[model samples]
Target: MQSSSSYPEAVEQLIAGFRRLPGVGARTAERLALAVLRWTPEELHDFGLLLATLPERVGECRVCGNLAEDDLCPVCRDPARDQSIICVVENADQVPVIERSGGHRGLYHVLGGRIVPLDGIGPEDLRIGELRARLDSGEVRELVLATGSDIEGEATATYLARELRRPGLAITRIATGIPVGADLAFADSATLATALNSRRPVG
Candidate 1:
């Protein structure tokens, strides 16, 4: 498995590590390993430092649960944004996709993940409690469930809709047929905007 002429063990270990990443096969991992080996000493050191410090440098926002360097994410802290409306998403990765659409001016709540019974993920495993707390604050007027159209996403939406139902609060689910199970990160801005604009009431 050692393809490198020099430091075979180190190169193979690096390749194996890369291979563990999603969508990265052995061939791609080998190529990445070779690329790293070819980098200058300073470049390699910088890259290593970035990887090592990334976790410590970035953390989830306490309010919205999005990746942030400070207590609150930019979206949550933005005064111009409509705090009365909250868009609920499955993860931080989906935030940029909805932002790119420029259709939503409300705040956001990241669930961290969806409900997947098969994978042993339940409503309690997500940020459902925090969402309920936010809803109880009486500040939010509408909760847009922007979760994916997949089974797990749907289940999560249903759970939230049922749990959060109350007077003076509007619960809506994003329009469907956006290539079910597809990650919102890959959806085009236009499509995402349309979906948000056409969201339907749930529960």
Candidate 2:
């Protein structure tokens, strides 16, 4: 489809690329492209280099599914962590929020995403197999579900809690004190701390 702008193809292409970003709109993307035009040659080169190298610079943690430069995330690599308790979150971004809460000293498991049947995303679509593999080691005694409070999140947590029951495994869900449908990734540290502290075992 033809762009709505009268700019040269290069500028339009740049705007189109920016528009593909998560929250960027057509106007915002155009503005961003214009802003980039004002950057110095060195700045432009640096930005291009960073964008080009992003894929190689970041990769999934083999142990936890979190973003990592190496095979293991920092939490997994640290010997001081409590390996007996695994906090499961919907995405890698939620890991930092919980870490900042200072409530959990255990390892994390990033599910990559929650189960949303409407979106055709199931347990197999996420990193659930990896999480199960981690638990099979018998090191994890507690599985804390830290998914969001939304419908999909609640459903996902419920499914996991029911499916992962085993002897010696204590599965729990983070407290629902946070507003309903709230995303855990953007929750305040104090709230996250409270949720983690008040987590109750799944019946």
lDDT of 2 by residue, 94-166 (tens): 8888899999999999888889898899889988888889889999999999888878888999999988888
lDDT of 1: 0.88
Best by TM-score: 1
Q: lDDT tens digits, residues 97-120, model 1? A: 889999799999999888888989
| TM values, all candidates | 0.87, 0.82
Q: Over 4 Å off in model 2, which ranges?
A: 1-9, 23-31, 179-182
lDDT of each: 0.88, 0.88
Model 1 clash pairs are none
- How much does each candidate deviate from the true structure in C-alpha RMSD? 2.3, 3.0
* Global fold similarity of model 1 (TM-score): 0.87
Candidate 1 runs further than 4 Å off: 2-7
**lDDT value for model 2:** 0.88
